[model samples]
Target: MPSMKQVTFRDLWQRFAELVHENKSVLNDLDAAIGDADHGSNMDRGLEKAVEALNASPEGSLRADAKLIGMTLMSTVGGASGALWGSGMLKFAAALPDAPEVTWADFVNALGAFVEALSKRGQAVAGDKTMMDVFLPAMVEIQAQLSDEESLPASMVRLADQAKAWSDGTRDLVAKRGRAAYLGERSAGHIDPGSLSSAFWFEALAGAVGQQ
Candidate 1:
């Protein structure tokens, strides 16, 4: 049987950076439809800087690495994504222990902190056509799976699928927050860029954990 595995902070950030680069154009296209058309470029730049910071000092603890990543992102990325995503990362990092690896429960706590930080920062709720649409449902599913004693990889796989579904479901939702809200009813038929990016984030996380 595949045993439970601990995830190193380096593994998590490396996968995230790779995924951001891989999906940059798609994220930009999704944003052009309803947002400022810079989500892809902004996130790419931020993650690149984050990866550089991580590579430069790989000896730090996970908490320190996460802090550097968050600070780098906040400084490098432009627009609301920088602030929101950076703040979320910092919040998540704050929730983690000062260790090189994390257990399933530790990851769940960090994920919950990230969601709460993003929600508070954006002041958006479910059905708002924001990243929250993807994140909230995934959090619920992960928590439910944990309660049932599901393996980490299995739970993450389910969370990734749920995030994708919720992201796609955003096409039917009118924007109630952020720049997309300016489009109002016009945003209904377009997928949310942030939600889509968030789906990729979870999918990459699932892939990383599955590899363990």
Candidate 2:
């Protein structure tokens, strides 16, 4: 029932949760280097609960779905990732139309709100070796591609690659936020687990959009 022009909120989150599950070990390994080795486990647990909540909920409004995801992540996920994703998703839910589906423009606008919330809450920027490294650049690319009138599915493919590249770029940055920051220069050689998971988030979007 999905179209190329629009994506259902349910499909999006489900795909994201799937991607995280598939890459759980990789994420945990990445986190092991610079922080506590629980990023993968925590996110996987949280997203699984979020998906279960989505499946159980009767209402299908976009805002409701997003808010449910936010609250579920907040309650289930632990540490900074939980707080950032949970609170940011609340902002995302608030920015959305209370409908079953939304146009690509609406999705992008809501995503911008989510990114802004993350930026404000995490206080991390492009060079901080955090999730923002991927998110900030992805936002710029998404907006630019939107303005160019590119199809969502195609643009999402490119965005997924760009997200991974941005996440890769974090390897050399000294961590300025989160538990990794405690390691100082030692964090420089490792990728941020949050950024890797963020890449999976974009990859999931690409998969959902492509399937549509």
Candidate 3:
């Protein structure tokens, strides 16, 4: 069995905050290419509230903390991405409540749940060049890999790679949803800002797991 260590909600939130802060400029640059250029600011606000919620966790378990994070982001982020991302967090919070450690399978399921929630809420599909461009392939790869074997770190690394691929590949796809969708063919050749930001976020999560 692979060794595992528990991560506190507060610690995880701080790590996420650090990840966003470190990549905020990059996210902004990516957004400038194909979006309104506010993803970084929006995400930063949401994560700051998430950190606060983590700090205030005095009752309930990890699940509740996750739900709180979801709710905070939903309330603060205030965009199509925020609503979908927040829904994903809320769904996952319910899925893994009270677990001492997260397994590879659990993590994969959570990713699927996040994507599913987004799909339901946003009603988008593959090649939409939204964040779905990053998550859909990454989740599919994760589902395929984890079905054969179970290695948390390995799954995380693979997912991160898939995310990177999707991010890069989005440059070849035309935007078909959200604000970028308005740009039509012009959206092609420019990476979807949402996709790029999501790639960074997954990479950060992989880093967090690697640290453990």
Candidate 4:
């Protein structure tokens, strides 16, 4: 069994930057089908700024780094995505401990806080064809697996897999929130860009943690 790795906030941000940059076009394509086609570029730019913010004022604790990322995204990213994502990041930051390395419970609690923040910000629930569709269920699975005493990488991989399934499930859901709701039944076939991007975030984290 692989030993648990200590994941720093810097590691999380760097991995997010790389993954979002690499998959920007794919996210844009998904968005183009259902909503504004700028999700990819906007997220990429925001994450890039987040990386810069972290580098400029290196924080010894994960909480500080997460706050910097949240603020940077809120100020730099465009569209509603910026507000929602930034709010979620801020909530995650608030939930984290002052320590540099995060334990499994700390990570799970942070994610739970993020989900709650996002749900409140977007006023979205499950099957809303929103990122919460992916987030809510993924968090459940992550919480469940927390009892297994598995290595962090293994647990993250499972969560990423669950997130992917939930993201894909968004394809069949009619939009109940956001601009996509304007299309009503017409939105059923297209994948939700937000949910997909959220999945990418988890996948990137899993990949980053696995490498360690």
Best by lDDT: 2
Report the C-alpha lDDT of model 2 over 82-166, residue by residue, as the tens digit: 9999999999999988887676788888999999999999999889999999999999998777743346678789899999999
Which residue pairs in model 1 clash with each other? Answer: none
Q: Rate the local accuracy (lDDT) of all candidates.
A: 0.83, 0.89, 0.75, 0.84
Cα lDDT tens digits for candidate 4, 1-212: 23222344477668878888998999899888889888899999999998988888854777888888889999989687899889888999899887777777787899899999988889999999999998888888877776544477787887888888889999999999988998999999999988988898888778777776
Residues forming the 10-long window of minimal summed lDDT in candidate 3: 1-10
Question: How do the predictions measure up, each by TM-score?
Answer: 0.92, 0.94, 0.87, 0.92
Put down candidate 1 lDDT per residue, 89-157, tens digits, no spaces.
899889988776656677778889988999888899999999899989888887666643347777778
Name the regions of candidate 2 deviating beyond 4 angstroms: 1-7, 147-150
Selected candidate, larger TM-score, 1 vs 3: 1
Q: In model 3, how large is the Cα lDDT of residue 85?
A: 76
In TM-score terms, which candidate is top?
Answer: 2
Local error of candidate 2 at 18, Å? 1.2
Clashes per candidate (backbone, < 3 Å): 0, 0, 0, 0
The residue-by-residue lDDT of candidate 3 on 1-212, one tens digit each, is 33223463345467767777777877777777778888888888888888887777775565677788899999998888689879988987777737656665665566677788888988778899888888887777766765433466667777887788888898989888888888889889987777877887677666766666
**Better by TM-score, candidate 4 or 3:** 4
Residue 17 lDDT (model 3)? 78
